[model samples]
Target: MSQTVDDPEGRLVSMIMEANKYARFAAVCDKDGNILWNSHRNNVDNILTLDETKQSLRRAAETWKVRDTLAEKIGRGQYAIVGYEKIKRITVPLQNGHMLFVSIEGEKPEYIKDIMKIVDYVERNH
Candidate 1:
C-alpha cells in the first residue's frame, strides 16, 4: 500500500487559510509577480486573471522598491503592508527573490499579527 500526501505548496496554502478567517487570497510568486501557487482557485475570493495577477505583481515590485529605499535610509523593513479601501495586502519576502502574498478583507489590526505568524511559519517550514 502507498500513502499519498498533499504537496507542500497545497499544505502551505491550507495552513494560511486555516490560520486566518478573513484571508481573501494567498499566493507565492516571483519578484515579477508570476504566481507559482495560488489559493484563489480553491474558492478563496474573486478569481484573479493572469493579467490581474501580473499587474498586482508589478505594483508589488514597485512597492517593494520604495520599502527597500526607505529601509536603507532608516532601518531594515520587517514586511510590506499596503491597505486598500476594501482589503489589505501583506507581503513577505522569501528566499530567492520570491514573495508570499496574502490578502485579507478589511483593514484590521489583527492582519499584522496574522501576517507575522504566516511569515514565520513559511520561513521555518518552507
Candidate 2:
C-alpha cells in the first residue's frame, strides 16, 4: 500500500535527489516563484548565493509566463534548461501550477536523457 505524505513537495525533493546521481539541488516553487520545498545533496557546494538562487527562480517563473503565452500555438512546454559552466539548471511545470527546479553537474550530454527519465518517474509516482 502507498504511504501517506504530510509534505509531498518536500518528499518529492528528496526522491528526486535519490533518483539521479548528478542532481545537486531540487526544489518545488509556487507559480509566483516562491520556494515551498527544496533540498541540496550533502557535500555539494552551491555556486550561487541564496539571493541569486531566488532571483533565478523568479526569472524561471517569468520565462514560463512567456511560454504560456505561446502555448496556444506551439503546445505546452515540457521543461527548460539553462546550461552554465559548472551546472545545468532545469525547470519543469507541475500539474498543480507549481514549478520544479533541478540543478545537476555540467558538461554531460547524457544528463538530458537522465532528466527525461526523472521527469517520467515524477509523472508516474509524484
Candidate 3:
C-alpha cells in the first residue's frame, strides 16, 4: 500500500553512510514516508512498525507543509532541519526533494552537524 521514489546522489550517500557509522542507527525515507534506504536494518523493521512509520510520515508532511520544518527550510534556502528524537538525532530534507530519517542510540550533535554538512555540500554541488 505504498510507493518509492528515486534516491539522492553525490555526497548525500557518503554522508548518510558516515552518519550511520557514528550514529549506529539511521533511516532514509521518501517525502511520502516510503522507505528508500536504511542502514543497520536486518529485516526492514522501520516499515513494519506502525508508530514509527506514522512518525516518519509526520516528519515528511511537516517538512512539506509547515513553515519552519526541514522541508520548508530547504525549500526556502534556509538551514537544514535537524530533528532531536529520543532514540535518534537526525538530519532531514535530504537532497532537494527527498527526506531522511536518522536514528542513533546516543546524542551526538556532531553527527547531526555532519549531516548538515552533507546537505550543504550537496546543495552547493547541485
Candidate 4:
C-alpha cells in the first residue's frame, strides 16, 4: 500500500479550506503584511498568486475606518474586529512569528483562531 503526505502548500490550502468552512474568506500573511494565501468557500486554492494575495492583504490592512482601540492594535499585530460589514479581520502571529491578517466572516472569529493555531503549529514543527 502507498500513502501520500501534503506538502506545505498543500497543508496550507487544506488549513485555509477548513477555515473557509466557517469564514466567508480566509487568508494568511507574512510579517511584513504580505498575503501568503486566500480561499473562498470552494477552497480551490487557485485563481491567485502570492503577489496578488500580498496586494489584497495590503489593501485590507489599509482599510481602517474605525478609530477604536482595536484599529490601533492592528498596526502592532493584535487581533480584533476590523471590518464594518459582516466581515471580521484578525491579525495573528504564525509559528515563525510572521503575521497572518485575515478578513473573514464576522460571525467566525473562532474559525480563524482555530486555523491560526494550526498554521502556527504546522510551521513551527516543520
Candidate 5:
C-alpha cells in the first residue's frame, strides 16, 4: 500500500489498526493536522471521509496543545481520551510531532489498555 511522506513505511498506521479488534478507525497525523496514513474496517457503516479525517486531525492537534499546556502546569501527560455518544477517541503522541489516533465504538476500557500497549510497542520499536 502507498503511504504518505510522513509515514513512508506505514508502520504507524499499521500499528494503530493492529492495536485492537474494536478499532473502528485509525490514523497517524502530523502536528499540523496533516494525515500520514489512515485506515478503517470494511463493512462499517461509519466510513471515515476526507473531511472527517481533517476534522479528527484538527481535534487531535487541539487536544495535544491542551495536553502540553497541562503538562507544563502539572507534569507530563500519559495520553488523551475523548468520549462521544457513539465512539471514543484515543490519541497518543509519537516521535517527530506525529500522533496516533484510534476511534472505537461505544466505551470499552480494555480497548484503551490494548491501544496503549500498541503505542508503547511502536515507541519502542519505531
Candidate 6:
C-alpha cells in the first residue's frame, strides 16, 4: 500500500494492517477514545458496531488514565493484551497520549512477537 506523506497516522494504520496477515483491525485513538484513523482488513467483517466500538474505546481510555496515575511508581505501560477465543486485542500506548488498538486473528501466543515488532515500528517512526 502506498502512503501519503501528509498523513502519518493514516500511514501508521496502513503499515500496521500490512505488517501481519493475522491483523484484522488497526486504529489510532485519542486519550478520550475518539478514533482518529482505523482500518479493517479487506473482506473482514467488524466484530462490533460503530457505537459499540466508540464506547469500548472510551472505556479503554478511562483505564489508561488510571494506568498513567500509577506509572511513576511501577514504570510506564508498554502495551496491554487481552485474548479471546476468536481474536487477540493489543493496545499500545503511543506518543502524545494516543493509543494504538490492534486486533489479530486466533489466540496464538507467538503472535505477540510480531505485534511487538509493530510497536517497535511505531516507536522508531512515530
lDDT of 6 by residue, 1-126 (tens): 324444656777787787678888888899999999888888888888989888978888888889999999999998888888998888888877888888888875467677667667766776
Q: Residue-wise lDDT of candidate 2 within 9-35, one digit each (tens)? A: 666677678767888888889988998
Estimate the overall C-alpha local distance difference test score of candidate 3. 0.53
Model 2: weakest 10-residue lDDT segment is 1-10
Which residue ranges in model 3 land beyond 4 Å of their true spot?
Answer: 1-7, 41-51, 68-86
lDDT for each candidate structure: 0.69, 0.79, 0.53, 0.53, 0.72, 0.80
> Model 1: per-residue lDDT, tens digit, 1-126?
112226545455566766677887777776777777666524545745768867997788667767777776797566777788888888877655667788778876476776677667766776
For model 5, residues 4-116, the per-residue Cα lDDT tens digits are 34433266566656556677877778887787777776666774567977897888787787778877678866677888888888887876667777778887646777777
Using TM-score as the measure, the top candidate is 6
Clashes (N, CA, C under 3 Å) per candidate? 0, 0, 0, 0, 0, 0
User: Between 2 and 4, whose lDDT is larger?
Assistant: 2
All-Cα superposition RMSD per candidate: 4.5, 3.7, 6.2, 6.8, 3.2, 2.0
lDDT of 3 by residue, 18-124 (tens): 54454544455666666556555343334236576657656654665464454344555333444455455454665445666555554655666677676677667
Better of 4 and 6 by lDDT: 6
Model 5 global lDDT (CA atoms, 0 to 1) = 0.72
TM accuracy, model 6:
0.88
Better of 2 and 4 by TM-score: 2
Residue pairs in steric clash, candidate 1? Answer: none
User: After superposition, which runs of candidate 6 have C-alpha atoms over 4 Å from their true positions?
Assistant: 1-5
- How far out, in Å, is residue 14 in model 2? 1.1
* Pairs with backbone N, CA or C atoms under 3 Å apart (clashes), candidate 5: none
* Clashing residue pairs for model 3: none
Compare candidates 4 and 6 on TM-score and give the better one.
Answer: 6
Model 2 segments beyond 4 Å from truth? 1-6, 124-126
